[model samples]
Target: MFTTGSVDGTVERKAFFGSMIFETVKQDDGALGITTGVENPVPLVILFLVLTAVLTMIQAIYRGLKQRREQLLEASDS
Candidate 1:
């Protein structure tokens, strides 16, 4: 997919390479579209970062709990 945009609007098209489906895109229900607006991807980027942070936090908590359990078992044995 490639896009060429001007202040007026943007021309967007999608094509599948090395696939027979590429021809279909040019026929009925063509993948060509025109979009007129400024695009903001910041929210999506922030959301991805937030999700990664949450995942890391969860992993850290799980590892800490596992380490504590091992320590408790070792202390009890001694």
Candidate 2:
């Protein structure tokens, strides 16, 4: 989840990661401010990539089956 606020013309942002929360506020002097929370996100990234690949394969297989069924029907009609 994310929330944003403004203080004296400066923008403040809050982000949540699991149970950790990080806050970032832009300074009025035009400097960037950031707060760090958890450091490693590699495992989450890898999991998402693997899940995407599996879903793509499943969709491709379903599409191929539908196309094959349609071709068989067309052949029977001829």
> TM-scores, in order shown?
0.50, 0.51
The per-candidate count of clashes, in order, stands at 0, 0
Model 2 misplaced stretches (Cα beyond 4 Å)? 1-39
* RMSD of each candidate relative to the true structure: 11.0, 5.5
Candidate 2 is scored at a TM of: 0.51
lDDT of each: 0.54, 0.65
Clashing pairs in 2: none
| Model 1: per-residue Cα lDDT at residue 74 | 100
Off by over 4 Å in 1: 1-38
Model 1: how far residue 1 lies from native, Å: 22
